[model samples]
Target: MTDVLRASKFSEWKEDFNWDTCLTGREKYGNFLVSILTSETNGHVINLNGAWGTGKTELLKRLYVSIAKKQHPVIYINAWESDFINDPLSVICAEFLNQLGYLLANSRPKKELVDINEALNKLMGSISKVAYIFKLSSLGYKAVTGDATLNEEFDFSQTLLDLTTQQNSSSMSLENYNKSIISSMLGNQIDLVEGMKEIRIQITSISHILCDIYGCNSPIIILVDELDRCRPDYAIKTLEVIKHFFDVDGCNFLIASDTESLQESIKCIYGQGFDSERYLRRFFNQKIALKKPSLYNYLLKKGIDFDGMCPNMTLTPYSNDNERKIKLLSEMLNNDKFELRDIERFIQKLTACIGYISKFNVKNAKFINFCVLAYGIYEHEKNVNIFKERTNKMSSHGIHCNGYISNGMSVSNFITIHFKMVTLANSSKRYNLDGGWGSCSYQTEMLTVESQDLQTRDWRREDLIECERLIQNYRNAPNSFLLWEDYQKLIGLTDAIE
Candidate 1:
């Protein structure tokens, strides 16, 4: 047995949401999102917007699972994955078809599935046409801007030839053929701006067939996750494709992203001073921020575990023990550099360090737990070993951090004096620190010490004061619980630790 807390409790834990717990605090918000999807409408584009790691993806997933009973077919597309592909149309086609296959899995008759497959292939041809138009437009852009190193005139001619040859099986010329279809969709004028209309018709056809095949009258709900983490072009283009092409009457889109970053991305692509938020607003009719979670309750519910401790101590709240710990945790976390995820990290570290305490005192569990978390928050998790190693160093090399000299000021005295205050605090006891161990705090009557408590076999009169000073400082400043690297930093040593 390793006598150490299993690090897996917090580090490897994921926030798993089920129907009952998913709506615990967010019942209204969950209902609001599902209501929008289930509302009588042709379709919708809803953005679940928030800062990075504010649980936007997690929120969307909850919505995804919760909406199942709403009778809507859902598809989750990780739009950040668009980075791997260069062509926008190909990216959309791949994500949509991959998820569509799953949604329609074994739902249709064999003959109908064959027919649906043929219809899907034709829809893919329309997608290929979309890719072709994009390629042509890129060449046109290079020619217009004179930004191409290659000869644009030659490239354009070669591209046109390739297009014509590829479609020569048809009677009409390639340009006339595409224009004829576009003109039909637009009723006369073919503004490439209205290119959306042609693709919209094709996508609508696909959605209808998909609905019949998936056996759902409700709209197909497509949840796009991790949009903000994608590159600027990919993120913007994916949104555009969904709006213009995939905005069919029977399909809905729920996109999750850091809306601010998406706005910043628009600014980056469209140039400074452009209203990126306005551009985003045009795409998303409704936006909801992910609900913020309470850090204290979240940690408490995690049920902090310590394997090397006495029974009945892991996060079992005593007489206001949780409150005391929460108060200190709040103070330490006042600086927002540590997000919810970061706080969970320190809580895990605290549980692990508490496992290493020798002669564990169940009475002082509250105070010790506070120091464990405080030390972890202020320093690295590996620094938990510093207490042991620092004591060993003091016993061997006579290095005292108390800024004083004393005979028989052994490591045991230092360890004893420090944990004593913890014992006193948990037990509602105090003693004088004016001339006692003042390492953790500078208050008189800070901790109680009895005659029997003072072990002088390897201690001295001066050692008592020095050890008290050491413990007081540690009590006052959790940063004093320093690892070896911190020591090297204090001494300006650049050499790596062995």
Candidate 2:
């Protein structure tokens, strides 16, 4: 492999999404979503549902770019990235104003732009007050304002004396003094409902301005990604902010997340019996589930060269047919329910094992299969005892067992039996040969085996006989046998590479 390909193989894969680079054929779905979002005049909330690592972020990015190409105003917010902030409304409002400024950068008539800016300022002010109210309710008045007096127990005589002192100095009335105290604690004197009403009017004006700048059919599309990865409070609050505040005409929302995970988040906030599904149903107009890409297509896009990983392996199961290797690997991944992120890690570790094998110039078919099986088991179980237990099953049952029967007996079963036989033989020495003749003494050196409790079942007579036969067959060709120590070394080598 070239240096570029080697670096690309182990590095994190970031999709640079465009219509031409959409390998999973999801651009068609993107176009369909665009049609739905643009066809409506009123606001619509779309829940784009997909499990983690199913490419939700890429789909949302593609949709954002596609909508932008049609001269529509769009904003993409990563909710996971912004969940550190206490208020999701603040994050959304900041992004909205930034994107809106960009959209109105070169618009005609400076007076209309000024009017839009004024309306946006009012809108932000209204949102700030609402967010402040939420903070006061959750964090307490003293925590928000840092005013110790607000938290102190009220004293009627002391309070009256303080008010009288202020009244004497500034000629302030008792009513005004009470209003000042309320304003100081609340951060604003406006009623929350009145403030919300003002926000709605300002949003209406801004939405009208956006329609005038673009077209009557154009609406501000806000795409929120990774909502499921956020904290439960942050995730639920984001949904509430979008539904209650931004549910105006000419404003649409496309939130991409695992709806099931988000539902669990809702349950976390409202308790187990809250009917989270019904709550989500009230926010979204439609829920569209994204289909996961096929394993073949995903690997092709990833550009994995299995042939290059182990070249010149005439004796291997997949030497002549790389497609068969891919098929078997795909079956293993699907059986384990490997997500895209898990698949990437598996490939990285497998490549590291192959790299270690290449140092010894041992790229045969059996060794290649051993590397694949070893890493697959490692990725799935991450326990040596589990690996030995599975291998032991292959020894006693001849690979025809329930879990070992997949991908046919030739490829899967043969590899398991081969792995077990080699490791068992190499695990310990058969004898300590020593002889004495007259005054001279002779001692044969024995290989020192590392103590490992592999948790294998008791060996049967047939298993020992097979182990002895295989050990003697490969006595002169030790390189053909991969020991348990060698497997451990291979796994250790992968840690550094990863």
Candidate 3:
């Protein structure tokens, strides 16, 4: 078998990977930042929700890199890893402080701030070894005139007085040249150890000093990725933290998550009252849903240039219309001459064949396999639904057995068991087949079909066995509402046997 060429995560693929690759989406993200990163809009949470494997993380990475390249100090963190099912707020705060320290270490501030930093450093060095102290108190007092308040002339003097006289670090204030210099360097800082509201105010104030007011305009963007990978609760809390802490002036935050997965999680955790749909719509200000490009397009963009990998196949423009080609392919797959069962069988065969063909270094073959698998599953589901609608009884799709029948089962029966197994399989590996057929192990049981919606028709005898165990396990338990419902649905099983 010829080896398939792997897609690049960097360099050649970078163009297709970055914000510029999706120009329209980039603009939308920028627009979201402009609307929310304002003085008054400090704690606005925004979610960048999309389906799983839809490149949300890729977008966030590129945006983070772009903002940093443009000279905005940026911090990218994966909340999923950091929070670990704990309160995300504390995690975010820790991350914020970590980034702040990094920024301070890399402070190549503007010329004015540079000068102030040096002067303050010299003055502060004479006083103490503490990390956060400015020693401009005596000099600041001398610089002030009586016409102005004494405190106004001396910045550090006020802080020193507060520390010594009031015996309280909280009483320390910024009032003189020290205040102006410190403010000039780091913006208006009432205090750092305060609550969320104060932190946002500080961020906004520093933003003014760094860009708007100070003329050194650079964008500060924060990218939070892998949110969907987190446990459902962590993911939700991460969203809340973004809303509370980072959505304000001079700072932009972008979050990426799997929308469907997240929605399901939210529904499960918060129940129906949360209005999962509305909540999602509001959170993800700029959601970009990416459908994996068609096989043809994917291959065409991969380029014909072969580096280390062999270019075993190629695509050329066909004289025939594209729609005509697609239609012909569809006809071949959906030929009416074939029996309904044959069509289903053909799909299984085609999926296996296509999967094998995808190993080649050609886009078309790879795409054909992808399309075939996707559409095959889609078509199979449709067929199952149609059958259900017409017959009213959920007939088994394929024939499979729990090996209980001494006489053996037919092919259709075998396939039906397989289909049902796939459809009703739960987290545990165990399942049950109809009748006496069930899993090899009696201890491990599967959730009943009544508990969850089925995705496919092929189920095994293991499915039924698993479901039986699950029903029994939850029997008489205090929190067995869902299981009870499933049990109730299975109470009258006369139809399934027929």
Candidate 4:
């Protein structure tokens, strides 16, 4: 099998259709993100909510590139990544400095910014040592800032005051800074609280300094992605970091995650009896959800690159038959409520399992797509017997189960499963004889007396037993992820049996 070559999508923005197509119903959603990120507002939290695998990260990536084109300072944190850190404050301070470091370098701010960088390095090291800079790193900071053995060894109250006093030619500014810095520190006798307060102030001061350096007109846009995937403790800590530390003048936070996932995480942290949604609402100023794209538009957007295909390409241009297959796939997606990632995953797995399938023969591709997705949704992928049996019932009952309530609501015994067929021989009354039978809507079907012939077909007990044959055959394949017997059977029970 030959592999299909793919192109780099980094420059895909150059193709105006990506944003203009409205295929995903996100044209305005993307536009709104760009507006908020580039807007003059400061200290605002804007949310982009979408289900897992529904393109939240994709949307943010596009927005990051677009807004940064205007020289806006933006910080992107994959919260899922930093969740491993023991200290939430440490993660917050680290990301803030990491991204700001790039902005400072990229903006080429005046020479005074040099002093700020030095101050920040010292401030960051101190915050890490005080909070959770792992054991080994903590030892280094303990030596640099103060001894690890004593309380008075590290004067948390004097960190900023001493740093500011060094620039005493500007004595008035130093006095005001010292008062604000030490007053809060001395008032809070708790050592941890004092360290946290200092960290928050340091972030705010840097934000203000950046705004001044970048001409004070640009609001820094911080994109926090994948918070929904973090552990509840990690996720909540991330939110607190944003609320307390990044909430300052000249800062706008655009966080991309689903409200439901975050709510669940909150519930996990607090008791199940807690009102998680209400608690989560305190963090964001506005939330915008990306609506699920319609079947036609969704398929259209996913299939656009298939126009010019090669053996080594990830996509294949549809022929008359492939287009028909796509229509059926689209209906399956609609019926099953498959999110963007699910659909893409189904395709990727389908391609790898059965490489280089012609547009004329996607029957097996469509068949495996549904089965694999069904097993995935149900978390039954590890059990082939259960998966196969469940697939049969799923197709027979005109039902679609996504395994869990949060992923999607399962559709059971529909009036008409639009993408499915109605079989004549058995209980699969809502099934068709051909896998591609349901895709044609704009055309007319020929009425014939030959339908009476299907009524007389013979029944066999072996037909049911052959299901075992299928299970074993799939297991024998070099790549078991894609089952290639094809969806010829997907037409319905009798279709496969006959």
Candidate 5:
């Protein structure tokens, strides 16, 4: 199965509010929200706002399960998934009826359940008929005015004339007569008004029945998720349908969305100058924003074992300590901001690179570290020249090996020193002039000075010594050294894996 399907299955089994695997500490917040939802007896609408990939959907699913476990009538609706349907009311009403049926299955006597189901079905049938009439009238108007393109030509004018002739025997002009027929067909909106009132009353009765069955005074909780991910018209229509048809005395709505994106969607439908925030204020009683998870904790929860042993240990002669690898990588990434999705993509790419490198048995810690830094820079800047420029800057600055040294060096500084040391050591060569060989060696002098500097800065001595050893090893086996071009090749090879 795909990861999405697997996760969906897992979410079904893991619905309790006190989940052991919730690393972001959201379970406590879920409990708190559930308490507030259950204590309220009147109709309410609460908007849960968070950025994309901030676990809004997961939280909503958990909330659905939590409320269900408490014997409260609750329903979960994914608005984006159902946005393809033209009417949001039908989608919502269908889900509501289905969930209510499931909740009432064994709670009531069979005859009572059948009677309640029959009543609900009858009310829904009436509502559907009224809704269908309104839809036909709307489509008729659109067809007549060329607002909606149809496959065949429509004789709406003639149709109106025929209706007018059939209804009246008095003499009347065709234009005024046609307007009268059209107005009576389309502009007499009281049918929908009366239909909605009936729907609200029926829903209020159903919700009260649910309250008695569930033994709770709270309103039925309806969760609408991913509203911002839907089409502009669908999202707006969902809010309107809920406010008009489902806003009864015993219903509560908790809409989970990225409100900023939802606001933009509203602007798309109602022009750029629309006051979307003020308009949204009419639908929601309060808005709650979810807290974003920390990067380290999120990574850990996503199954990144930073402290575990390095894989393919036999492929390389380096120590099998993965903690150092994680430390260096965390230092490199800690200052940057990444959404949860971006971090997941980064981890996927990193895993692919490590897997490809393992095939070549090139598991040197420094090499892996460079791969991490290169991919990070590429992701952020979208240009390899930034990597080259940093290295070039380090070269021009004379490799300041003795200027300052510390265990807590910034990633930028560490990257410069690390790459420069490798380049200087690997570039050492001998030139033959007039049949005599002369050695041009600056690496030895730089290493000597760096060693002396490390003696004074003993706190980071081990880290600096490890860097010197890597440089020396690369100098001894220059073929194993990875230049910028080699790093690019590695990246290219792994890019297709994801």
Candidate 6:
């Protein structure tokens, strides 16, 4: 294909840049689901939790893409944007029916509804078992009474109709029904909803036949993202309904949420007295914490050739191609016929001027003029005295930046030292130059030194103070366990992995 190099404002932020692609295959999260799908153990539900912008969605998306391509039917739904305002069971039922309707519309028109509903009911039964295992399943319990044995005569419709039609339906009967039928039989035991549960049960009973329409091998996996956005009651109730109904029937569920929110949501449904840890343990078997990469490793990974780059180059490149582009710019500026050594010498002097003036209350315009004059010597044939004259003019202006050091002792000498040190400390590989990283002491002292207007104090003192505390705390208290823990968390994220 011919190279197309069009440029426009709209294209600037477009995904076509392919910034997110990687050259090699990185680690995948497929192992987490392997056991859930293959083992004879009870079906699994997992919550992939993390902070916003931390790559939870991306990881889930990739995992879904991989698993689904193998012919396992995967359905993705972002609950954060869904309009599921009804009972949790109703939402699941609606989704199942919608999917089943699509699956069976052409093939089995006659038995479509019946097959689907029967499958749904069986699946719901499995969900009830899971709920019972989890505890706090629901309020209803079943028992035998007049007319017939409870299992034989106590079906959902009759019980719901009996509850609604008989004006004298005792709360005791409702309570018993909850214990025997609702608790033992149905998964999302919402039967206590002021006739709302009964209503849901009736609807679920009628619509559940959709599950049978799906082929036996065609199990569906529904992925729900951003449960963290739901109200606690809504979020927890939704989770329970999913566990009891959907998860029970051989359908798989993957939830993307904030762990804290999911915990709080469960608390709301099962009551604050519920053991939050145990409740969470039921759904999430393992947790993967995610965070941003450390600055030091991040910069090094960009493959910066720091020693070849100018110390004053503020527009740092994030990739190798950008670094080449910058090197080209550097070479263009050098071709003005200034000796390469002279250019380096002038930058040394300029850095000194910047340090001195930055400490004082010099006008920005004057600073700019000084920089222009410093660089003007390259093109124009200015003698050494003129350079000295311009340099002396700033002394009375309160910039003590006039002295030229013997290579190692001046404030100007330390400007590059300081920049390189900070860069290396953040994410660069190592100190870029030879001589054993000797500039570190000078850099540290320079960093601590107060400038004329105390600009350093205003800009960086609080941050320095925090750093000092961290150092002191690290020294006096415990081990570096917390630091290592945090480091591990940073790498397990999609942002870092991608």
Q: Tens-digit lDDT track for model 4 on 1-498?
A: 000001112244434434654456666767777786667455788778888778887677666655655556666678887677755555554554444443433333444645565554445443333233222333443454354521232332233234444444343433454444435443555754765555555545555555554443367777889989988888887888788766766678888888897898788778899998888789888888876777566776666333233233222112223453455456545633467776665555444333334343443322233333322332222233433443322233224432222123223311122112211112212212221123334332221111122221231223222322333333354233233123222222221121
- Candidate ranking under TM-score, highest first, comes to 5, 2, 4, 1, 3, 6
Location of the lowest summed lDDT over 10 successive residues in candidate 5:
1-10
Which candidate would rank higher by TM-score, 1 or 4? 4
Question: Per-model C-alpha lDDT, please?
Answer: 0.51, 0.56, 0.41, 0.49, 0.56, 0.38
The digit string of per-residue lDDT tens for model 6 on 1-498 reads 001111111123223222243111212334455335423123456676665544556555555544433434444555654434645554554444333323333233234443344344444433332222222211111111122222233232232223223243332334434455544334444443333333334333333332233222333556677788877766777777775555543455677777866677677778888888687777654555534323233223445443233323221221223343323223323332333334344444434443433444233211122212232332223233333333211222111122232222333322222222111122112121211222332333211111111223322333334333433333353232122222122222212211
Once fitted onto the true fold, the runs of candidate 3 whose alpha carbons sit more than 4 angstroms away are 1-45, 99-103, 114-194, 212-219, 280-296, 304-498
| Residue-level lDDT tens digits of model 1 in 158-220 | 322332343344322345666555454435455655666656765555556545544454677
Predict model 5's lDDT versus the native: 0.56
Alpha carbon lDDT of residue 271, candidate 2? 95
Better of 1 and 2 by TM-score: 2
Number of clashing residue pairs, candidate 4: 12
TM-scores of all candidate predictions against the true structure: 0.56, 0.65, 0.43, 0.57, 0.69, 0.39
Clashes of each: 26, 1, 34, 12, 0, 23
Better of 2 and 4 by lDDT: 2
What's the true lDDT of residue 340 in model 5? 54
TM-score of 3: 0.43
Scored against the true structure, residue 462 in model 3 reaches a CA lDDT of 45
After superposition, which runs of candidate 4 have C-alpha atoms over 4 Å from their true positions? 1-25, 110-205, 304-325, 349-396, 399-498
- Write the residue-wise lDDT of candidate 2 on 404-497 in tens digits: 2233343444345445544443323234111111221333222211112222243333433444444454465556655545555556556554
